[model samples]
Target: MKRLIFFLVLLPSLIFSQTNFEKGEKLFRDGKYEQAQPILENYLKENPSNLKAIEYLGDIAGHDKSWDKAIGYYRKLKQMKPSEANYYYKYGGSLGMKAKEVNKFRALGMIGEVKESFEKAITLNPKHIEAHWALVMLYLQIPSIIGGSESKALKHSNELYKLSPVDGYLSKGQIEEYFKRYSSAEVQYKKAIAAGSTKKGSQMLTNLYINKMNQPEKAAKIKI
Candidate 1:
């Protein structure tokens, strides 16, 4: 009788907590972060390892550009759910953003962490689009001495091409433009335009014609 009574008492509390969590999650889904944040935070005090709550908290912080707070939540979530590709992507993307705001020395320290997180994300889900985009930018922007490689950037771009052709061509175009390969960049940018990334492609092509190719008339008359 005593054990049965204990179970009966505990069941309602568990049910109530679940209902409460669902309510907060609904608010989160509806984009009411401020209203959802406190409720979720309160529930997480008791269920500190709840993945849903942790992910929501990370998203809230990230939306506000609170990088440190967001990173903390994502770091905890990734630790709890290592196989989740989105967690690694968000964590690495946040690290990349945070690197820009810190001193050059601190930024240098974050580079490896940023790269590793993106790599893990890609490894977990090779078709992850944002992870490929992140890798493309990272490889193109960073110096070769510190692991940057246009070849690697192109590799990811080709991989993206298989998943999303416009993105792939745009990425390759951007990388070529970065290396001042004007003709090649123009070719890929034109491909991107044909593939429906028209606005950005137009801007890039115009910039190339006027700024790099020194064809101002061509830039002015350019159309996507």
Candidate 2:
């Protein structure tokens, strides 16, 4: 009789918890981060392994810049779905953010982990555009003595250029500029301007031509 009474009492709580989770999901989708947090916390307390909820919670944490909590949620999600590319990417990005908040030595360690995670994401999904772009950009930012390679950046940049829309010529130009291929960058930026794809392309071209290519007179002629 006591067991039956306990079960009856628990059923409503279970239903209420489910309702809360559903409402949290709806609120999250509607961009109500403040309203969703408590509900999600409660749901996570009850069901920590809920991947969708965990993912959304991690996103909320990231949106709020709560890097530690975001890393925790993403790490949990990654544990559940180790082979998922998006999970690995998010986890890597979170770690990278955390690394930025720390000292240089600690950041270096996290950067190594970040590289591994991003690489795993790319390996899992070769078409993951953001992962590829981020890896290329990170590589360009670091010194060549520490695994950074302008040639590798150019390789990924070319791949991205092929896959990107015609309007993405500015990005291609930026990548070329990073490789010190100023002439190619100038040509790409000019093409973007001609295509009417980017309003800022002319200004960017002016900067690159003057500062990078040492063509101050040519830069002065650019209208925008």
Candidate 3:
């Protein structure tokens, strides 16, 4: 009688209840992260290695700005779905964010991994805009001795242009600004404005006038 009673009490905890899992998922989709986290966490305790649960928990960690924890979850997702572009991109982005917050040695250590993850993401999906853009930033920001190259940045800019016309001009504008070619950057930003991305185009052009061109009056008068 004692053994039977124990089995009955333990059955609920042992079962992989779909109802509980789906309820948690609904809460997640509804953007109720606080409510969904514990529910999803409890479900995973009973059903460890649950991929869907792992993915949401990763997102929750990102929302919480717990970059390392988010990276851990994303790493698990990447292991489970090696060919998934989104996982690699998210993992790479989280690494970059964490690198920014850490010491120089640790940030340097992560640079290669961050590049590799973004590379994998773009390889899996050529149209992965963020991955490509992130790579462009990496190439632009790091020193040429390590990996940075304007030529490489330009190549990605061209690729981005092919993928997104608006972002293409904006990216080209940024590259010109990096080289201190203010007039060239202005041309690209103008092209972007003419192409209908007025808001970003206007902001970049305004900054250029005020910061690069030293024309604060012109910047203040400018309108999209």
lDDT of each: 0.92, 0.84, 0.90
Clashing pairs in 1: none
Q: What is the C-alpha RMSD of each candidate to the true structure, in Å?
A: 3.3, 4.7, 4.4
**What TM-score, over all chains together, does every model reach?**
0.82, 0.76, 0.81
Best by TM-score: 1
Instruction: Kindly list the per-residue Cα lDDT of model 1 for residues 6-76, writing each as its tens digit.
Output: 99999998998888899899999999999999989988988898999999988998888999999999999
Residue 198 error, candidate 2, Å: 5.6
The Cα error of candidate 1 at residue 96, in Å, is 1.3
In lDDT terms, how accurate is model 3? 0.90
For candidate 1, the 10 contiguous residues with the lowest summed lDDT are 215-224
Candidate 3, residues 91-204, lDDT tens digits: the string is 999898899899988888899999999999999999999888888888888778779999988888889999998888988999999999999999999998988888999999
lDDT of 1: 0.92
Per-residue lDDT of candidate 2, residues 1-224 (tens digit): 99999999999998998899999999999999999988999898998878988999999999998999999988888789988999889988888888878998878777778878888998998777777777777777766666788777767666666766433576678778887889899889988888785558888898998789888999888887
True lDDT of residue 104, candidate 3: 84
TM-score of 3: 0.81
- The candidate, 1 or 2, that scores higher on lDDT is 1
TM-score of 1: 0.82
